[model samples]
Target: MFKGFLTLRPSCEVCGLDYSFADPADGPAFFVICFACIPSVALAVWLEVAFEAPYWVHAFTTLPFMLLTCIPPLRPLKGWLVASQYFYKAEEGKLVRLETPRNDDLHPHSA
Candidate 1:
């Protein structure tokens, strides 16, 4: 399903499913930044505040941890999101006309 690490193929090879609808965009990145990166940031902050850690400590510890948390899960998360979009048939909303009774239909006896 993937053409590259973060890119998708144009369509599915086996099922011939078009990938045009799989526009996950920054959803995977946003999730990684919001959910995954927080703990790494917290750890860095705590180290700085509590232990007064040096830059090299962060380089060895926090940097690797952040990369591990943030980068690796992106492809899986994006695939899951795209699969969900396909399964749920997610699409843009459209304005639809509702059928309501006109005056003639509501007051047929009055006529």
Candidate 2:
């Protein structure tokens, strides 16, 4: 069984503005950011067929092209890629929260 998790911030904490849910049906912008790898994966498969390359070679070669394609479009997709990882875990335990403060909040003198 595959279970997916999405941590959605559906409102502005400061302004209390309501945002849409992150679910695919909600038509939120989250999926645009989160699914950048889908194109890359598809391209890899297409390249494999188009080039008639071995699976490993196609996989490696397409990676650089994918990176190139992804970089230009990253402004819209970056948030989604970052947030999508929260849905998967390496082990069978609940996700652990790290208490690290944001870089902006850390004082230069404290470091």
Candidate 3:
């Protein structure tokens, strides 16, 4: 499911930190909302259903649950996003560097 959502792979633009897509062993990053976060989210939903909490309670409870789910996993997700913007090109037994446009440049129109 996440594979479809992530249109770009993670890599370091400056350091050429690209992962091998062909390798079957390279599972999705923990922070990318794979199997681990699902159970907690499901549990949160169950709590909401079982307790019949008011809307505000459900909304407040969800914030912490989402933080728990998201915070730890962010490291790898950020690394991957950074890496995806760069790649290594070999030339004459040396490596040449290339970079994608910076995030700021991509969103210049935004306030």
Q: lDDT winner among the candidates? A: 1
Residue-level lDDT of model 3, residues 68-89, one tens digit each, is 7766665556445444432333
TM-score between model 1 and native? 0.83
lDDT of each: 0.95, 0.53, 0.55
Which has the better lDDT: candidate 2, or candidate 3? 3
Candidate 2: Cα lDDT at 62: 75
Candidate 2 lands at a TM-score of 0.30
List TM-scores for all candidates, in order: 0.83, 0.30, 0.38
Candidate 2: the clashing residue pairs are: 33-80, 34-80
Better of 1 and 3 by TM-score: 1
Please provide, for model 1 over 63-85, each residue's C-alpha lDDT reduced to its tens digit, 9 standing for 90 to 100.
99999999999999999999999
Pick the TM-score winner: 1
Model 3: residues with Cα > 4 Å off, grouped in runs: 1-31, 77-111
